[model samples]
Target: MDSASVPFAALDYIIFGVYLFIIIGLGLWVSREKEGRQKDSSDYFLASKSLPFWAIGSSLIASNISAEQFIGMSGSGFRVGLAIASYEWMAAVTLLVIAYFFLPIYLEKEIFTMPQFLEQRYDGRVRMLLAIFWLLVYVFVNLTSVLYMGGLSMNIIMGLPLWGSIAGLALFATAYSLYGGLKAVAWTDVVQVVVLVGGGLLTTWVALDAYGGSSTGPVGGLTQLMGDASNRFNMILFEGELMYQNDEGVTQDAYQLLPGLSVLFGGLWVANLFYWGCNQYIIQRALAAKNLQEAKRGLAFAAYLKLLLPLIVVVPGIVAFALDAPIQRGDEAYPWLLGQYVGTGFRGLAFAALVAAIVSSLASMMNSASTIFTMDLYRNYVEEEVSESKLVRIGRIVALACIVVATLVAPQLADLDQVFQYIQEYTGFVSPGVLAIFVMGLFWSKATPNAALVSAVLSIPLSAAFKFLTPEIAFLNRMLIVFFVSVALIVGISYVENRGETHPKAIDLDDVEHDSDPIFQVAAFGILGITAALYVIFW
Candidate 1:
């Protein structure tokens, strides 16, 4: 390695040191308020439903924007083109739907963990199965991915060994999550989101400035750099290619919606609804809001935040590609871009921001996992009589234990070339089943516990077949096919098993109100309008 390329310097370390201190301090500050409370399951799990909309919204954004976006999504942008940005842009609509269509049911019911809703709709067995599945998925896919990539990003930025970075992240996450729970994660995330977005925009601006200042001069310079003349067909055509993957750095188009129709329709929609609407790690913050109005406001805030995410996470990636930086691996772009454009004091702050993003994600996942374990799994199955204080104590222990296990697994994450792909591949195992069961439970009264269990059981093998048997089929297409098949299986079997007798309780949608903030509606429309304008421009 070159002398300049050592993983970190005193400056980088100092920045990270300050970041760690502030985050831990925030955790301690949030913990102070809970010092003498009853420390019940509700308090340990949902922060006693006392958070404001801004804090919940910021925490949601921070939890979602991990090293995966900074490292993986940006790297994908470098390899392919702007097409990879759909993940960010499309989520705006998803969040809007969640805010208006989904959050009401959850907030109205006052559910602690989402799996609890499954029990209310189905049975204890379904709830237990889902809780276990979600718990494992969080630890293996979400938690591990966050820590593994966070460590890798730090190593690349600082010129340190990967293990050192992993240890550092683990220690920081453990301190915040174990000591403070959701309260700590939420407040620290507020600071984390600001730093991360600022750092990302700074990187993107530097990249664009570099591209625009070339000898060719601004417009000519940017166009020539961004275009691949030899791949005319790729540039004009969009559907056939996965927007996020470029076989060899080709400038594939993002204009056509046909290729990813499934993702645009049900596949991506299902994932987003499941993720933002019902998932523990993402929605736990929303559930911690002081009231239904606050929860709705928080979700609207997150929706607005989602609309702006592409500016921070996706645009820099496009810049990376425009600069002709090597992005054979999607996880390499952010570090490569940061290493190229950043220097000195700013580098320290940017590095600190990246660290904060990773820690925020880790803390979110760890806290959520602890919640599911303590409230859904342990309280229901293992220890039914623990007091509130003891429950909190158990949650702290569970959080630390999960961190240790995930850290050990972090080193093995190196072989997973594309972090986002790895996340989807593993998550697909359970996401489809979970999504199916949740949708049915919420909207279909006739859906039985047996049907939920059977659909979940059958969806796994069907998903695996799509993964291994038809390897050439796009992942999004496979998800759509799996979703329909699972739906068919569940509905068909339920009809037959019930002998044409449907459950008599009708879902009361009349009680659901349409009271979303006007600002959010405007922002949602603006996102759609911008997407349409982009399509027109490219066409």
Candidate 2:
């Protein structure tokens, strides 16, 4: 599967080049500082807290829908069918919850990073600990995984070497993000989202057209694909229903990944909430909103976008399976389709879309990692009265260092069969406990800092013990156990330490009134209703 084997024409290269130029130009132009006013830490990190609803919304989706969704989740679609879409569909509901419940608290406090919120609620020690944890996850897990998947896609489709692809992506992301910071990442994301979605839809349409043959239109092609591969569209899987036999000669069930109806009601919620509400890279865009109403509107926009993702990512993989496309692995399904069906000009646009996904995510992650380090650790711990210019410089240095580290680690993940699932399974160890702590710290007035600290420390070990000790339980189910145990520890410790003293609330939820926005309320409820309807239809 060399580059020569793929149908990449001169037109495709020209299209890709044009796309790169336009995006880089746009990112720089939008993020440039005013003539006289140098960019302070506020401008560099939080987009000067001036982002409108549309930029916030588009940036949120661009930051989230990376190579993982494009390459890895599509691979899951190829292997496990529509059941894999629970991640996307369930996330819609999670976004709604974050918009209404979480945004009010965050905006009221006017925090730059999630760690800052922790410091306000608990203490500086807790904030520092979580800040370091987030930095490590962003560099190693988030940055490295996106690089690996993006490189892998380029290798399969364009015949580029993996290392070169990784290096190119790292440098490209750093070019604008390091200088312009989140403003560049967010505003450029507006265009990237459009290109990503449009190009993705083009790939799907072209692939379906090819599958249907010349005479049949896209509608007939879709109908034929559905009727022929009806089994692949089932959104639920029961135990003992074998999906595929692995290299170890063990037949794995679909329930192993999705775990039945629990996807709707159980541990998936913990994963989604932690990702949408608490995660730095995903939530940073929303945090930069000019107002709570704007942030809420942005999240609602993201929710609507989430609904359309399965069409671009999951449907293409299912179509590949329907055509019985030959490929070595499930992750190869997307690139394989692009090479096979997409024509010369369209192929370039599609490749640009993939690059858009990879680059936007890389920029977003780098900016967030920089934000946490500069704000949480350096400015607070090392230099209490750090100058704004010096802080911006430190952030750029940190962003570059993160990219270098992630590039070094990207190649190591090549052996993973499904990188998307790999990320989810490993992150589950911490997400559940972290979510538990946040939930209690926000709502439960009795939660002590010690209790929150203990839960954070124990989450990984508890999740690991369950993984190695009870190998048969699904990872999602294991997350539920970790969450409950962590919550119980927090509650028990808080009760003992507080000792009948009723402290003030950790977060003054009543201080900010977020319920007045009727349009936002209507949109939020609409999203919720749509989510419910989707589950019912899929179920």
Candidate 3:
């Protein structure tokens, strides 16, 4: 499965190069310290808490959707049809919950990282353990998969060498992000999201237009696609209802990846809640908001964007499937579409959009990984008396180091089939326990630090037993089982430790407002209504 290159015109390179210049310049400019102001840890790591709702929302999406969505999920679309969109659709719902529920707790504490929240909730040991879990997953799985998937797309679409593309992405991400920190990442994400959505929509239009023989618009093209591969348009897939060929050339069903009802009522919630609420890189933008209202609005904005995303990311894959695209594997669906449909002049912008998606996420991941390393690990254990300047510098150094490690390991992903699903299944081992720990810690006052530690320790073994022993259960259902077991462990342990009394360390949110704003409520309901309508129409 070697990537076949496409013809990239001189104009395309010019557009891409110009885009790179502008983005780098914008990031540096925004991250610069003002006159007479000293750059401190707050300024470097949390963007000085100056982000607006739009910036927060846009950066959240920018950080969350990378090569994983553009290449991997789109590839999933080619194979599994619209069922893959359950991830994005469900995430919209998750963001609302995160905004109304999780943001209140995080903002109340002024938390800098997810581990920091854990420390405040339980103890330093729980914080340190989760910190290590996050650092390893961020570098090994999240960053490496994005690097390889982005590099794979670059190779197939623009004719770049794989290793060169991967290295180039790292350097490009580090250029502005390492120096400017979250400030640079958030502001530049404002521009990047515009490019990402515009170019992404353009790419989707090109693909849909081509799918209709250049005769139909997006609506007509969608109709043509639905008519062509009717089986690929379902939102829910029953066992044996829909079959797709894996990278190994074996027939399989989407049930394994997205089990039918569990997608709605069970395990998908565990995945989305952890990703949107607990992931450091994704939630750091919301943490930088000036107020909780802005955070809610930002998440609401991101939810709307999430609602529209499947049209951009997933539909093109289905279009490829309907058009009988000559791709070797599912992941190549996107790059093959870019190389074939996106024309000479616009290809540069499309290519820039792809690079923007990759680099922005890479930058966000590096910054958050550094945030956790410096704040949770270094400040706690390495040096308690460090200066603000040293902490900021340590953050920068840590950011660069994570990027370096990810680059070195990313090429190993060449052996993977669908890197997105691979990431989800492995990250599942951590998500169930994490969600359980936080859920009990936040809502149940009787949850003890020791119980959290037990839940955290048992997550991997429990998930592993289910994965290996059951073998027949779908991964989503397996996560559901692991989540319940982890919760049971926390509950049983907490009762024995605290005797049903609220733990001394449990959060008391009596003073904090427990409700969302009226406007935010309106927007939240709108998002829900739209999502429900989409499911009904596509069901």
Q: What is the lDDT of residue 279 in candidate 1?
A: 88
Where is model 1 more than 4 Å wrong at Cα?
2-12, 34-38, 214-259, 326-328, 499-507, 513-520
Ordering by lDDT: 3, 2, 1
Off by over 4 Å in 3: 1-3
Residue pair clashes in candidate 3? none
For candidate 2, write residues 1-539 as lDDT tens digits: 56323857999999999999998998889877668988998899899999999999899999999899999988888877778888998898889889878889988888999999999999888899889989988998999999999998899888888999999999999987888999999999999999999999999889888888879977778878878877767676777663764324456787878888779888899899999999999889888999888999999899889988998999898888887777766778898888888899999999999999999999999999999999999989999999999999999999999999999999999877778888999889889889988998887888888989999999899999999999899999999989999999999998899974544547766676676788777887888787778777766
Go through the candidates in order and give each one's C-alpha lDDT.
0.73, 0.88, 0.91
Candidate 3 lDDT by residue in tens digits, 384-456:
9999999999999999999999999999999888888999999999999999999998888899999999999
Model 2 residue runs over 4 Å out of place are 1-7, 246-250
> TM per model?
0.90, 0.97, 0.98
Ranking by TM-score: 3, 2, 1
For candidate 1, the TM-score is 0.90
Better of 1 and 2 by lDDT: 2
- Residue 53 of model 2, lDDT score: 92
Report the C-alpha lDDT of model 1 over 1-539, residue by residue, as the tens digit: 42324355578668767877887887888777535556566766888789998888888889998888877777655555555555666676677677777777777778888888778777888888888888888888888888888888776666667888888888987887677788778877889889888877666666666666755544553465457422321222345444434445554433322244454565666566667777899988878998766776676677667666765666666666656665455676678777777766667778777877888898888888888888888889988987788888888888888888898988898866668767865676677777888777667667777888887787778889988998766666677678777777778877887766655432456776666567666766776786556545543
